[model samples]
Target: MKKKLLASLITAMMSPVIYAQPLPPVEVIGTPDEINQQRLSKETVQSNVSATSDVVEILTESPSVSVNQAGSISGFPVIRGLADVRLDVQLNGMPLLSSCPNHMNTPLSYVSPSQVDSIEVYPSITPVSVGGDSIGGSILVKSDKPFFAPTAEQVTQGEIGAYYRSNGNAKGGNVEVTTANDKISLTYKGNMAQSENMDAASDFKTFTTTTNASSGTYFTSGTEGTTTDKDEIAGTAYESINHSLGIAYKGDDSLFQATFSKQSAPYEQYPNQRMDMTDNDSNKLNLSFDKSMNWGKFNIQAYAEQVDHEMAFMDYKTSKQMPMDTESETKGLKASALIPLSASSELTVGTEIQLFKLDDYWVASPAPLPHMMQPNTFWNINNGTRDRYALFAEWEKELNPQWKTRLGARYEMVNMDADDVHGYNLDYFPTSGSGGAGNQTTDAVAFNNAKHAKTDHNLNLTALANYKDSDTFDIEMGLARQVRSPDLYERYTWSTWPMAAIMNNVVGDGNGYVGDINLNPETAYTVSANFDWHAANQKDWGLQVMPYFTHIEDYIDAVVERDFNDDFKVLRYANQSARIYGVDIAANRKLAENNYGDWSMKAKVNYARGTNLETDDNLYNVMPLNATITLMQAINRWSNAVELILVKEKDEVSEVRNEVKTPAYSLVNVRTSYSWNKLRIDLGVDNLFNHAYDLPTGGAYTGEGNTMSINGIPLMAVPGAGRSVYLGFNMKF
Candidate 1:
């Protein structure tokens, strides 16, 4: 499909050199903004493509939500007012389950922009088929179906394309090949690169020549400076590795996809207590299928993934080794169906089941034996897992031309089990820790004694109403009740590592611990409404605007509290109330008539603000108001484009003190492409202007009061990359 799109983009670039005309405003397809509105395709509620991309560069740059990417490792997407599972993510109709204790992966880690067909972000609840777990609403993501790549017709057979982007020594490439016939077709696409990121500006009193001022922990950027150890706050530059490959198959009745990826990076992150997450390796395998027939359109998918991570950062004023090594895996399946009864009605139903697992194979060699439970010795190992299943359905009907109503319900079940399989309990080993080594004590390869399990049930009900095509505006409203259970981390594991604490890597505290056994699933009451306006449309010009809101009950998240030991700390999962709301507005204009190689301009601005409602605290990682403008030029076999992007500052923060303060900024980027026969080439400069910035603080445990390393190095402000560029090429036979 990317091949087809590239081809079409090429044809649009070539074919008669007529200047490109601006396109009409596009309606969102999946967002559940107002009551009874049917938003699909050109109308998918307000889709948020950012859900499947990296936080630093994904789509949600609203004014209300603030998002900060922690180095290249993990990303936190601050929604209108929620984070974690409170904001559900549905990928290709299936949930992209996030099962990490630290939320290393959110919905954003899955696919890139090229693989997306639409993004549906219901900043507010609007339907039941989309689920009811959202206190911060939801995002429904769809990938391009395996269809022949599209290209303007000169009459066609196939097409090919390539592109390059770079800044400094930084560079990358993208290539796509596609072909299709009336019955069978396929699209193959991939991107690969090696580049250096720019150092991040510091969080001190000065950042750049034109920096900002800080009062307490609050930072307002306007007049910026580059001072303090501010420069030290920058993430490593030139640390690199990124690549991905995908294939889509299309038949008269179905679509199938297979994909794989590998990525790596070395850098320090911000708002974190530890120094780094390095020697990191990640592997992913995914497969999915979709089919439509007389009965209905159905979809199902299965995927497995692993992250081989290593990090030797400063903690407790000491250096805990890297790859203290931890690995995580997820395997699961999901299926859904949509059946049409009449032109005015449809019924949608689906079920999904998946198993999530985690294992921490400590890299400490000499592996532990039965009698070696001495204080600092390598003792045991552990493996943990969680399983989940959900069934849901919804029915919709048009009561009249201007009014639509719908009803839906869902049921979910969960089961979890975890234990420390191999570890000795010599004189000092806790049952939860890896066991001992040598003499008189017991020794084992995989101990299976310490274990635990739990089962859960949840149900949700929904109602929706939409009033469409009324004057020049539209409205949609919806309400839903949803329940969710605690995952693996929320239930098992409670071992301390000499590796926790910023100044105590050599000291001691349980680094990766688990919460108590008695915990309740989170439940929410989500109500949402949307108001949309097509304020204007003239020859080659159009405008669109939308806004919405949502509320949640018993929100689930980990909180900090003193532990049994007077000098220690541990995290526990608890239920809290939360409410979130936000809005999106966009517009487009034809730069010229479709004649003379059509040329045009496009731009969008979005914003969202979320609150815990209970404490009225900001959810971690929410995005802030943002806007983008791009100039597109369409010509004969040749075309190019340029863009300007802007993101504002974020102030709302979680209750945790010393919380990182984020600053706002802007950027510039450009791209161009050319086509000859079935071959094409292109180039792009992301962060074209190369602005330096830091994401929201990603928390790393710091013992009571310390931030220095074993080498006496004060923790640096971990920020993402600065400027980057890429160069890529490709062709079809």
Candidate 2:
């Protein structure tokens, strides 16, 4: 999605005095040629963020991005062609440490969308200062920064707002009270939100196409079945409670802040997912401090977060499952510094470490095992941990006033370990549903000893050249080398899908499953060029176009066995060559701003194609051609904006059989806002036409051809949220 406004101040961005603080080596923020996403002129996360009206709504405007889900409220965000854990997620500059055993806790779940101050995404060419074992991209979700009181005004502040939705009787409210002085600052904020999603829409495409031979389900247009928004099960998702508090301090030379948050769900269910959870209690805490100096600045941060996810997963076939489970304890630490040696050169160095572990206590009561199968006798446990560390540095040199260059590199290493893995027996159970949660039978077989450990060496580099003129246009071009390490799940998590896709019948059995300890990282070589144009004091029109291409030498992926009739075949992680190419164009302009209501329009178009060199086919999940257009008329306090979005159906396939192709569709939305003094209200209409459709899931698994899943395995589709409304109120005092 293209934003309607650009960095319009060509003179301000190009002026020799870009910084008023005497040039103590300012972090590059105002340079339009630097690829900065916002106009904050500071490195503070708040300045780079784009406050998304809603989480899913955010992806509609982003290029080369998509989302998928089995329900309306929760889904996975796909960046580039990678989804799930392949993307790097940061909260307050620290990692959240993902441990989603069943992909239950998506990255977005770590923070509430309404509470986000900014969300800056760095596509394929991620900055080493943030990206880790990420393949698709990196996203930083920053909490709102403290709103300082004007030096000439009182040191008091407050804000309050409420939002309501139609479909699920959704309602949320927020209030903030703050006070700040010359040296100290503080803000306390709270919110209450809940939603009943029995009104969500169902995906029709999934109902018509299937690989099942025994079941005959047809497709018909209109409200043929249930037109309700959500699925048949009302409890698939439950109401939630959210609360948070924060404290901060700032002086002429130093800054410090801390935040505490809590979120809970009373009950949750998903027909598509075998396991159900009664509760997910999460507690999060973040703290960081930065010191500014004359020649350079140094930053440091420490964080700790824990999630006690208690869930009960069930197996339909055997009438057995894991109930009341717990996955607890995740922690980490990080620190960085920047130093300037001369008038035109600066150096940045940083390091980070994190450890994530899981403890699953499962018990099964299979109905077929015996007559009076004990309720909890069968017990099994799985304990695993992953440790990661990295060292990085980036340097910038000003070859001349109108030219500059940047170079960066990083070295990283990661290791994983698992114990007591032989806790279940599969000889008597062929599915995750057959035995209790403790009955993952494949574990008792001849397990690979090296599955518990892995080692990886990752490196990165970036070089750029820029041109700028106070009265003319500016452009920037760069070549970067970024590599993502294999996630722990891609390595040690054994037979991870049988429990999730057995009923589908098209899934592979873990009969011959072992991880490749010698797998290499997915490395990419990317080249990009972006240009920005401004018309001085004219109508203020700007356009930016960036085209990039990436080539991967050893892309790690799980390939299927060609000839295997055992239902499921040998599954191993292997390396392959892949190439991706795409172009992104976005423009914003004030068409005719004479006096007939300042007219402006914005548009963005992006397309990408990837191929697996080894298979001679399209990459598994490349994003299709997509675009968003918005037109608006502005008059003082009232401005109306209308948007039309188009997403071409993607039918490309690089995998075998070429069976999985998503359909095409379009969406429209309208937004209007009014402002008065320190108060403002905005309203928006999403999917104004209420169109129903299917979006690509940017993920692929081995199956028996394109016939769909044989056993009706519950696969989630990124269904578009149909016909919705949003109202936002902002107040400052």
User: TM-score winner among the candidates?
Assistant: 2
Predictions in order: lDDT = 0.50, 0.56
lDDT of 2 at 476: 74
Decoy 2 TM-score against native: 0.79
Model 1: per-residue Cα lDDT over 642-681, one tens digit each:
7787777757755432244567878787765555654555
What CA RMSD would you report for each candidate?
Answer: 9.4, 8.8
lDDT of 2: 0.56
| TM-scores of the candidates in the order shown | 0.70, 0.79
Model 1: worst 10 consecutive residues (lDDT sum): 214-223
TM-score of 1: 0.70
